[model samples]
Target: MAKVGRIKLGSQGLEVSAQGLGCRDLSGPGKPEPDMIALVRHAIDIGVTFLDTSDFYGHNANEVFLGKALKEDEVREKVELASKFGVSFADGGNKVDIRGDPEYVRAACEASLKRLDVDCIDVYYQHRVDTRVPIEVTIGELKKLVEEGKIKYIGLSEASPSTIRRAHAIHPITAVQVEWSLWSRDVEEEIVPTCRELGIGIVAYCPLGRGFFSSGAKVAERFSENDPRKRLPRFQPENLEQNNTIFERVSEMAKRKGCTSSQLALAWLHHQGSDVCPIPGTTKIENLNQNIGALSVKLSPQELLGLESFVAADSVKGDRSAIGLATWKESDTPQLSSWVAA
Candidate 1:
């Protein structure tokens, strides 16, 4: 196995590999099962032991798929598995609902545990904040799971800075999974600083900008009808054309640095801080290898600055997701008094 370095998440002593495998896309519709399993195992073999997935992914299929892949006692023992809850479909997937009530929290943990076929999940995240439920209430339930040995740590995904502080006050949030990449720097203004202050680690999902940086915008235009990226504002035709400049800059720097654009992007994230881990997912072994190779692609101070200046936040256009998708701005900083009154 390659010797990728590890970093500590929060003060709980939860350490994971520098790069985690985002397992969400592994078992999507019509994807080959065996290839997905092989890709995950290959990730583990290459020192990518931290796996990120959610219960809602493929409507629980991702967890079940991971359960099968990690069924071997040794394989299960070697990996630090993280899965999430708190998003479900209604009206046959037309309407989306977010639940964080204590009852739902306990039930979700139980279902995920059974689906994952593990005694305890290493890290369990609330996939998205349920605005109806207090952040404290959600973390309180997670705290119970930790006490009962159902989960080792708690995480929040795409939560705002204020919500993170409130949740941490209830229970130490082990990680905050968000979209942090060359294109998406919205979290840096508040979320990243809050996590650092509270000792909460960051798990950067879409660190490659959802293939925008890796494959280029031209290729992104080919997203199929069912592909989720097609729904995102950034991947729309005009926005994609504008975003092509960001990719062009990255590609140019990657060539100068003698690394792939994907590797450069991952390396840029690594340079952000020791507490940040990027989980870039792929179904191909070659792409998995390329992601792992990022561990060795060190960027000097000047190069890091160059890339940062090239893809500054304003350089990219379009919202990170479509309007209805829960975002950090809308979900962060809930009024504690409102929940208290309720």
Candidate 2:
């Protein structure tokens, strides 16, 4: 078991492991389910007190899988559960349907609670900004649930800075979920800074760029015909070829530092600030343990700066996302704000 790294979540009373586990991809389409139970349990045994899941991941498959894993003997109390709402599965496939109405908010939370088989959620986040419904009204209903003892904290995911500020004003946002990494530093300027000023924690998803940082996982495999990574611009031929150079350097640094590329990447993200926690998601036990190993690899500011410069110097290869998906929920800057949802 890895030793836990503790940090305060926003202004809330809960303290969690600095490196949490993201459970979305475990049971989602194109992932292996046989590995999820042991993988999640392995995370819990290794000081991963924070576990994040969402209802939209495969039409509630992620939540139901988590429920079964949580029922393991004496494992339920070991983790702090974070679930999300505001995005529903309109069809059985991959499409987000926004529903932030107060009634819908309550209903979504209830469904997530039932799926997770938990009495109260440690953290409940809106999966995305429902531009139709005012964020304040969403918070109003979430706060009502807080008063009702159904929720512990409110969060927003992939929202703009203005939305974050507005939502926080309505209620103290304990944490904001966003895809922030060395590769995805889009949250540095206002979103992350604002969270710091306001004392909210940043839960960095995709800390590994969806397996881009793993030890033996090469960029070439992602370009395979059936792989979804091919659909992402960053994984295109030219972009992938150039980006692999960055990975090469990352691998070199990892060898020099006596760790793997994934560990170095996760360590750097965790060491960025005490308020930031990176929940690098993985479905393989080896990858899960490798990620947790990051808690012990403390990087100095100088090393972090060096890595930043190296990444910047290396051509980013391609845009992180495609046209609409690249937008990441309507932001207009290289750096944008983030909010929470589940």
Candidate 3:
């Protein structure tokens, strides 16, 4: 196997492995605990030193899984652990709410720390931008956590270009986590450029397009009843049928390149720039190994252009997610001078 590489996130000098492990589904209703722990430890053994999880994932169960996975003092020191807050669950995890108030921010951080059983998180993020709260105020509280050693660096997720700038002005943002893939190029419009100019690294989540690009439309039907992607517009039957072109094109390219479609998707993100890192999550070690192999698939300039042109000609047919949900579109806004006016 080729040696896995590492990249520095922004100017904070926080280094993470080139391919981070997204731990959202590692532990869940159907996932076995021992298997999940073994997968995490295996990832570390192979140099995948960055782990991404959210406090809201599995309704706080994911962090607890990590706590058990990395219980050993020496094992915990090998990875750069990142987690997010700002989203709260209600009505038994059916209803979702976004909160960024100073009080909630503090409370959320404390809760995450306890759940993960860690003294401090390496990178803490506001999972979703709360349009009602001023970006400055939200980041200001994070800055205090950094000062007090609760978190080493700050990050934002699904934030707009304007919001990113506003937050960065208050304090340097180490990274911005957003869904960026062949099927999700909206970020390239403004978010990517802004982060580049501001020296903020991008942690691309869902880089496989929620398994759509790799598994094709048929995968949509296999989603569990509770799977969140079932609610996404792109996964609907009509949209999925229309989006088959994307899968076909990517599959063709992967065959020519001698890589799996999933690997091709990840390699595309890798080719974008050194500042972009995609944290592709999976419960199976085979899938994890395939994701890691993406680093080795090189694309020629013509091949890259061909893929881009193919996507441009046969664009994805639906919104990334259902409207009115907490998403990148909802977070795009100019900085507010007062939260009261928002």
TM-score of model 1 relative to the true fold?
0.96
* Deviating ranges (above 4 Å) for candidate 1: 332-342
Can you write out model 2's per-residue Cα lDDT over 1-342, one digit (the tens) per residue? 647767887777778887898887788666656667878877787788799999987688889999988986967788889999977766655566777778899999999899989888989998887776677778889999999999998888887887888788888999998887777787887788888888888899989876787732365564557666667777777677777777888888888899999899898898888888888887787877778788788777788887887578346767666666523347322211343333
Q: What is the C-alpha lDDT profile of model 1 across 130-233, one tens digit per residue?
A: 98888988888899999999999999998988898899999899999999999899899899999999999999999998988888887675788788888888
- Candidate 3, residue 66: Cα displacement in angstroms equals 0.8
Count: clashes, candidate 1? 0
Clashing pairs in 3: none
lDDT digits (tens) for residues 165-258 of candidate 3 = 9899999999999999888888898999999999999999999999886689978878888788998988888887778878998899999899
TM-score per model over all chains: 0.96, 0.90, 0.96
Q: Evaluate all candidate structures by whole-model CA lDDT and list the values in order.
A: 0.89, 0.80, 0.89
Error of 1 at 167 (Å): 0.7
Question: What TM-score does prediction 3 earn?
Answer: 0.96
| Range of the 10 consecutive residues with the lowest summed lDDT in candidate 2 | 331-340
Ranking by lDDT: 3, 1, 2
